[model samples]
Target: MRLLFLAVLRPHTGNAVTAQRVRAHLEAAGHVCVLKDAFDFESPSEIANLILAENFEAALALHLYRGGRLLQGHRIPFGVIFGGTDVNEDANQRDKNTVMGRVLEEARFAVAFTESMKEMAHAQWPHAKGKIYVQSQGIATTPNAAFNWNTFLQRSEINQSADNLHIFLLICGLRQVKDPLYLVDAFSEWHQEEPNVYLVIVGPEVDPVFTREVKAKVKRSPGVRLIGEMPQEDLHAVVKNCFVVVNSSVSEGMSAAILEAMDLEVPVLARNIPGNAAVVKHEVTGLLFSNPQVLVLSAKRQNDRIAYSCLGA
Candidate 1:
């Protein structure tokens, strides 16, 4: 079977990663998959032309509004995998919500990364409840041995020793929904007290206006630096070296960053949003913070624990 896979294929974005993974799985199962970026085409007819040209048997879209909107009016059967923003952000919009509802109504199947996400979709579009399936993405990490920590720190203009630095790596695309600046003030204040501590924000620049604001904020902020984007392979190594992984997004479906941190055995400090709370068990797998102050306090407490443990040994 030949399938057309549609997603927002922005570089270093989660939707692109998920689309590639799905394509790999379909191909492994002996199906041919044609992957395309939903943004490349303007209308349903444009998508129809591609589908007809490729002779695709089925279609798979990553986001309801961003990707699924294009899959509409096509004769071929299609499934939609919920993007984080679709449920967390766009569902609140009157026009977008209506379009999403229609998309789900016509979709042969749907996927949610977590049970809570599935429940949210069901509440919004109860008619498609049975067709909505929950499937957590499979994650695996392998850090490259050749990655040089000192070189990365130098290139990122971070002045600290690897042994003493308590680096918190916050990974997210530079967009408003991510709220990458949420903990900037708290982390900066904490840094004044603890000179060895640093908070690094790394990801692609998705919003130029927001990116400019973040860069300006980082310029004035101490111990907080925006590294923009790093290659995925190098990022895994950077994640491994960090003292803690952070997620300060205002909303999320299921953050690949949090999961990747857990998989890499790096401690995580995530915003206490429902999506994050679902994945992180407080004081167990990782810590969840309701606000910047809470996050700062939690990090301090965790650091104290580590200090005590080292002294005891």
Candidate 2:
């Protein structure tokens, strides 16, 4: 079978990763999978045309509203995998919700990473509830033996000494929905109190305007650094070295970063949104913060505990 896999293919984002991973599995099973960016095509007709042109037997999309929307009236069958923005953000919008409803109505199957997301979709469009399946993204992290911690620190351009720094790595593309700036002021204040702490925002610049604002803000803010994207192997190495991994997104379907951190045995400090709370068991698998102040205090206490245990050992 030949399948058309559509997703928001921004270089380093989770959506792209998930689509590619799914495509690889299908291809490995002897299916011919063609991957395309949903954003590249303007309308459902455009997507339909491409599907016909490519002679795809089926279609799979990463986001309901972003990708599934284009599959609305197509003759070819398509499946939608829930995207964080689609479930948590776009579902609330009147226009997007209507389009998403139509998309879900026609979709042969839909996937939700968490039960909470499936429930949310069920509530929004009860008719399609049975078709939605819960499947967690299979996670695999590259362990780069050659990655240098000192080199990574130098590239990140931080003034703090790596030995003493309690680094919190927040991996996400620079965009408003990510809420990357949510903890900037609070983290800075905490850093002033505990000089060894730093919050590093690392990922590709997906939103140019937001990226510029973040860069400018970081210049004036202490205890925060905006590092450009790194390769996945190097990123995994960086994640292993961090004191904790952080996710400050206002909404998420599921965060690959948080899962990666947990897989690497690094504690997570995540926003207490439904998408985040679903995966991170507060005080169990990781910590969840409702606000910046809570995050700062929790992170500091966790850091101190780690330090104390190390000294005792």
Candidate 3:
């Protein structure tokens, strides 16, 4: 069947990764799945026209309000996936909540990244509770075997040698919700005591204003560097080489970067949030820090407690 897959395709963001991964799976199973960035359309009618023009059999979307909103009243039997903001952020707003409720009502089904997420959506739209399914995001990574770690560091314009470098890579877009600067000051202080350690925040410049703030802060904060967005394959290679992968986001539906790190056997240091907690089980899977202070302290303690090593690193 020809399927329409709608999602916010922000370059190098989790939404784009998830949408592409799901689309690839559908295509592998012999279905023709076409991905469309939901932001391109202004209204449901625009997508409705596309649905008819392309003759898509069924539709699927990543965010209820962003993607599912376009599928409403289209009679295309689309499924809605609750992206983080729609649950953690948008559910608190009256106007967005009402529209999302309507979207859930018409959606053939809905997907939640974690059981907690499913419960959140269930609480918001009780009538659609039965239709919401809990499915953890699948992960795939292609780390280049011959990837040059030193060259990559130089490209980021950092002048450090690659020996004994305990790189803590925090992956997030430069946005308020992502909180990329959460560990900057703490990590910088820690780096002063331990020169071998460094914190690198890398992702797309999602918001211009927030990007400027992140750049300004990173410049003054010693041992913290902000790298531009990278291709998925290169980023995965960097993750494999890094000592730990960090998630300092204020909210998340589910983090593809975290799951990919676990897959690569890299240790994770994530913020203490329900979304991060669902996967990161403290020291067992990775370390979880409650605040900025604990961010550095936890890393210091967990340095010797790493259970897994990156393959071929």
| Residue-wise C-alpha lDDT for candidate 3, range 188-269, written one tens digit per residue | 9988888778899989999999899999999999889888988788889999998889999889989989999989988888
The local lDDT score (0 to 100) that residue 307 gets in candidate 1 is: 28
| Ranking of all predicted structures according to TM-score, beginning with the best and ending with the worst | 1, 3, 2
Candidate 1: misplaced stretches above 4 Å? 161-163, 304-313
Order of quality (lDDT):
1, 3, 2
Please give the TM-score that candidate 3 achieves against the real structure.
Answer: 0.94
lDDT, candidates in the order shown: 0.87, 0.86, 0.87
* TM-score top scorer: 1
Q: Per-residue lDDT of 157-216 in model 1, one digit per residue for the tens?
A: 788563478888999999998999999999999988987889999999999999999999
Candidate 2 structure, TM-score to reference: 0.94
Q: How much lDDT does candidate 2 score? A: 0.86
Error of 3 at 60 (Å): 1.2
Question: Which of the two candidates, 1 or 2, achieves a greater lDDT against the reference?
Answer: 1
Clashing pairs in 1: none
Error of 1 at 232 (Å): 1.2
Record all residue pairs in model 3 with backbone atoms less than 3 Å apart, i.e. clashing: none
